[model samples]
Target: MTSTGNIRPMNDKKYKHSVAVLISDGLGTFEFGIAVEVFGLTRPEFNFPWYKFMVVSTQAKAVNASGGVSIAANYSIEALSVCDTIIIPSWHSYSDKKDALLIQKLREAAERGVRFLSICSGVFLLAQAGLLDGKKATTHWKHLPKFRRAHPQIELDENALYIDQGNVICSAGSAAGIDACLHLVRKDFGSQIANQVARRLVAHPHRDGGQTQFIPNPVAKLERNAISNSIDWALANLSEQITIKEMAMQAHMSDRSFHRRFRDTTGVSPLHWLQQARIAKSKELLETTNYKMEHIAELSGYLTHETFRVAFKKRVGVSPSAYRARFRSD
Candidate 1:
């Protein structure tokens, strides 16, 4: 037994989940990459069970990605109705006609309790199929205008990074796809597996999608640029005290404007954004390195193990020790 009292790895059966990414023409390359990276690749070292990712097309022939990149799918819509989880990467441009028959396949799966995920404009396809009706959802902020007009029944959340409304989930835009996928992994397997995958991908392990997506897109004024610079600086000095006043001062904006714009920019409050970032740092340490919890707490900006415990459990729904015990590969 480890001195930290983390549990021993369970002798549990690996769940060979069959995941299918439902693709159409004009799929976003980055969104599709999320599906491929999460469930498509195999890592022998991580051990345990993994998913069998299938790229399924609605047509018989080839499909073109958004950037004109062509993809060869292994199956067709027939497989979409049969997978453990069905991911709607993105709907083709709204100007295009969404095939009714293809929507039916995904709708059937949703009705049968199959896990459904949508990235960017893909929520429109789910909305058109009536799967997102009366459910809270989101998509690329730019698409919100047409999306809301087309489907008023679905509750569209503009500020969220991704909202997992149980069986169905939606992400805001291209990059938000990572947050949605990581949330899916944590929900299915545990924090351990999700964190490991993030490490392998060398990406941010956690970013609360609920973090606001309203940051001005074109990299606005010099002040906004300062905010961006401050963000990078805070991340490098996470363990340092990061207060709203301090961040605002660094960005050269009035505290009130900084507060409003920070939420506008990141979709999360400054404190929450930092906490999520800190938690991600801590999760990485817990899984890949054998750092003691005390040191992890210090590095992650918690003043003590008890504070880290409460914060970690509140955000992740698991005790740090328990998470490490059940998921650490070595």
Candidate 2:
């Protein structure tokens, strides 16, 4: 019935955070599992406190998940008031009638500054609660049309993998939920801890929330592998002055062909991907090492400190020094 795995740690230290995953009937098991795997699992390997996670529902009744599975909540909706964050894994449907009691609870939690994160269509609940009014939100591409029609007041970002509006966050379909959760972990703990959790899950450490959600055309297997290999090579050589010609050579394709395929596979231009990769590398260095801005810029493939500063500020909305001071792991 009720499950509270790893909510209690070995030591008596207070948990640094608390999370409540709200579930309902017709749940997306994969999304629910993502929340559980990321927040509910205990990591004794880490020295710091982890989240105290629990499942909550509007009622104590068991809900039906996909594939004929049933899950019961560990706590009632009232438990949400005590949580630092509340995760809505999935909801019934856009057409389903709103739950007034649950909506009231969500509004109350928002007023109290509890962070709300919704995966996929679970955003509908937040939208119904008026918590996402005038705020940008995203959902599975399939649900975008209905969501837009239903909540014209909410700004819909169909291309984004997730949108973080301060206390409220909404993620796109399925795997994108993992990215959103990891982003939260990175924000709350640090990149190092988030990366460690990502490693355990065998997922990418970070994906920019603004990154395009899906590639339009799927490349053939061989072509896909070639594109993947090129990305791997680029990541390995972030410090090098990588050119489109060089990346094409690595992929064994003509420059034009490589560019097309890379965009088709990754949903972004090759140069844009490179810039994002370099920014990611610079962020890791900023958070982990005491390297000066010039050194970090060099390591992140920028030839000049001015170029690095401009790029970092444009993409991250903060300067290198500010990012380092805020997110550097002690």
Candidate 3:
């Protein structure tokens, strides 16, 4: 194995992973940095099979980063042929068009079952290559409207942090890329190695891609209003069986008014919000303790274990037991 400071040509067959991160002019530094951090770093001391990282330049010449900093992209688009995974961290904008050669290379790679990961506007590239056509994909929530307008044929999920369509995986902005990468690690390796990687990075090993993207506007307005007080009361009293009447009473509004205002302020009905809160509580219990389903259901304000399981599966995208098995530290 030959060593070069940070960049190297990993030719060893035993390494088991070959990853190519696409580089171009005006690349998002943070997103590219995440790829390097997750895959390019050397980790021989950990005694685990790691990735062979290549920053493949879309153009022949060196490129300028988002802030005009020069980056030496030593590998060419031909490097994509040797890679099993290709990541487009972030395109400069949604309007950035791909050349015919790059589009053809991506299409051929997808035909070979090479995993494609797109961060932020990078999904535009996969969309241009026709990899995400008729597939459920996501990007940064801020770009949701434009992406929808640009490609209405693709099933775009604005609420998701990411979407894994098997071969073509797309993630939202910045940190969500890390989540998606860790998920790949978990899929290729097991939870143990993925957890080890996450520990080194000091990040959560698994965040369900279905989790809603953080939208600040509605949450901020809700917090500034009286409804937040009632929300807090509901959180504190999650162990008890509660209903919309309690929520309306706490907010000092009529049931109809509370229903309308709650939906308006939080973008969800009071009943849905309460169910989410209960499911969240159950998740905490599942991850932290050895409580049985009955005890957890009761403590989390579910009238029955059956009700708890149904709601937990619907909201969290996993059963309580499965979530605990994957995430429980103990």
Candidate 4:
């Protein structure tokens, strides 16, 4: 397998990584489609080489997907040996019964340092193969209880949209898989390239994996729209010191009502949301600019450089300078 541990800058003329999308019976077509759309599609418009993609199966045969769809896999599991990354779109039935041969191959692949990505219930396959025993993993929220019961050793994060444990990555559910895959693109290429890919897909360019999943809401449309509008206003004014009272005023609700409705709409508190938004903005500036730390902090809504550094490091797990060093596009 090719080395994906240290990806170089995106200025390279060619990206040599080969990505294999693993398909099996009872596949989630939407999740499978997400993988194919992100990694499989050829983007001739880009100046560099896109991923060398292929669809593979455990038995190298046709498999049935959800909703009565069937797809024929031209490559077998043996093909994974030469691939740099394997995307397990989904598993068959989320069953406890493990495929001995498949498990052996997966373990071998892990030993070789090949990357593994599981979408939704596909985490079950990795868990059953013993790949996620001591690692942090997450699946669709609906399966959290069962996942915990089955894999008590794995540290499960209930709120994360996705979790990237170095070589192993797991996504929450169907749509979150798109964010996870786009994140891999950003890691391999740069933020600019990833943003372009996202534009083509008509999806959000960047959603931090730590952002909480959208909880089901039975709130009225008017209330939801008000909260959404307030969120938009806050985003537009991220450079300013935004107060909860100001936000509540924008939503046209009392502070208490705004608090409850905001939490109901977005899984985090209003303050938490503002902090995350500021962090996200700081990250974008860091990735795209060579500005000084103080200037970046000011632009990201921090009152002082010290506060910005503390908040950024706390939220992102790294200081601004270090993050720029790792992910800066130019």
Candidate 5:
């Protein structure tokens, strides 16, 4: 997603909603751009009241980024006062020292009603300012050990894409920044507007802040490779009552070993994996054909309508009927 050497509001009368994006040395241009793309870009198509964004630095001058790139920061720390929302994109350990004045300004800004967000390593700066005390927040998973050791009082959420405790929003590593920024847009506007923007950006419209951030996750891919032939066989004959033992035999493993290995391979248990796949297949039938739920449940390998409903709700976040209502047949 980098191009040309990495080339990267409105006022709701109720909020006036000006956002101050605080930048410092070694900032991640990509993270800053994500904030700008959502907040600064003029999206007349969405016809929404957009936010005003300001790029403020610790000091008003050219600052050095990682890899020795220089960018100008025209605004000073004084801009914090008028901001309705404040975003801190990142902080890097430059010569192993953080700017003290920057932490003071973050403290001052938090004391006001300004909404706060820290993407990736920016949580370090926020935690240093003591704004995250007693609030559940997330950062890049790599920083969890050090962050907890530094601020044990702050509740750290490791599994989520992001976490929103009203005034404060913290995102997991890099991509979660988009999820958080889009979420702020969705919260201010509505699902229709958010979906429109997601279409423009070619990103998902709705990801709950609590969605899991998969780390490395070679286990799923490796297991899927081993179980590929079996999965294909199961898919072709889903109408048959396929037992776990049958699948274990196909993968050439004992039932007990298959149970442990499958759970380790996928984040979920074998039953949940089957249920997830079944729910996806049923949804396709629901949209393309006039199949009844009972029929779909049977065809999709779900044993009963009640079991399908429970599994569908648990995995898809909606009932089959509700999903079809929201989706188009075409």
Candidate 6:
């Protein structure tokens, strides 16, 4: 059972393609639930091959989850031998040492080119199995310091939503698992199938792995309403040239006070926020319209196309045209 000699490609004809999820005590149920939601459901409508799913427990008996819940495993570690894909939802605790047998099963799976994935803190198991050595991986941002201290050999990203290294995949915090699962569908099938799955799940169709996990949300309302109102006005008038003075005036405050308060509330300067808003608007235009570069620049509050290109590349890591080509729908 520990050997991967029986491992077969997903396209193998004799045995139904298998996906085994590794479960253990103290694991996050939400991360494990995502695997079941994404891969366990039957999709006869797609007219594609159906995967055989099994929950493989690391131990012999029922495993207890975070909330005093116990999962009766349908299979033991031996079940991993035949699986085309192995998923680890979340290893809830970094302090616990994984059993050697489970680690050996994973290592053998890796040797056979079997796809293995981890969501959130589940990455700790892969690192324990030595699968993430020298590979760039990511986990929940809060655990970054601990992950770095424990496994200095692995390259852990603090910002990415997910990272794929062929056979091994790692996803960021809790919700990011959806993006990673969709990415797997997209990679295994195609964009069309991925989009269909996303629609079925009522999730965003695509959010590339390179995108940031930390999006700066708007500040909560303050007692002083003028600043929020002015910010709203700025969003409405993104096409026009706006200045710090205009924003301050709209807030009925002097330049110095507005700057200080804006920073305190939003964690960014007003001008910086304005630039981000303009860039966001430009992305919307790029995805939904066929606007030319100059027109888009003008509409997004940039004075020149050259300035727009520089700013977009600096912030988004791609040119306007490239972004549109990748994200344009219909």
The TM-score values for the models, in the order shown, are 0.71, 0.92, 0.66, 0.88, 0.63, 0.65
Each candidate: RMSD to true structure? Answer: 8.2, 2.8, 5.9, 4.1, 7.8, 6.6
How big is the RMSD of model 5? 7.8
For model 5, what is the error of residue 288's alpha carbon versus the real structure, in angstroms, after optimal superposition? 23
Clashing pairs in 5: 9-50, 9-51, 10-50
Residue by residue across 2-116, what tens digits does model 5's lDDT show?
A: 1112111223442336787877768888888788887877767844346766778775567776666876765677677667788988886223365677777777777876788
- Error at 152, model 5, angstroms: 2.4
- Per-residue lDDT of candidate 1, residues 11-116 (tens digit): 3245467788877678888899988998889878666677767788877767888777888777767776567788888886466476878877877887788888
Worst 10 residues of 6 by lDDT: 1-10
Q: What is candidate 2's local distance difference test score?
A: 0.89
- The sequence of per-residue lDDT tens digits that candidate 6 reaches over residues 1-330 is 222344455677633568888888887888888888888888866664766677888676788887778887777788776788899998854585668888888889898889888899889988999999889999988989989899888887788898888888899988899889887876565456677888988987766575667645554466147778778989999999999889988888899989877766654678878888898789778777888999999999999999999999986767999877876656
Q: Please, what are the lDDT tens digits per residue for candidate 4 over residues 29-85?
A: 999999999998889878668987778887645888999989887577777767789
lDDT of the structure predicted as candidate 3: 0.80
Give all candidates' CA lDDT scores. 0.79, 0.89, 0.80, 0.86, 0.73, 0.81
lDDT value, candidate 6, whole model: 0.81
lDDT by residue (1-330, candidate 2, tens digit) is 553344543254768788999988889999999999999998888887888888998766799898899998887777776778999999875475978888888899999899999999999988889998879999999999989889898889989999988899999999999999999998887678889999999999988898889987778999999999999999999999999899999899999999999988887889989988998899899999999999999999999999999999998878989888888988
Q: What residue runs in model 2 are displaced by over 4 Å at the alpha carbon? A: 1-12
| After superposition, candidate 6 runs with Cα above 4 Å error | 1-16, 219-330
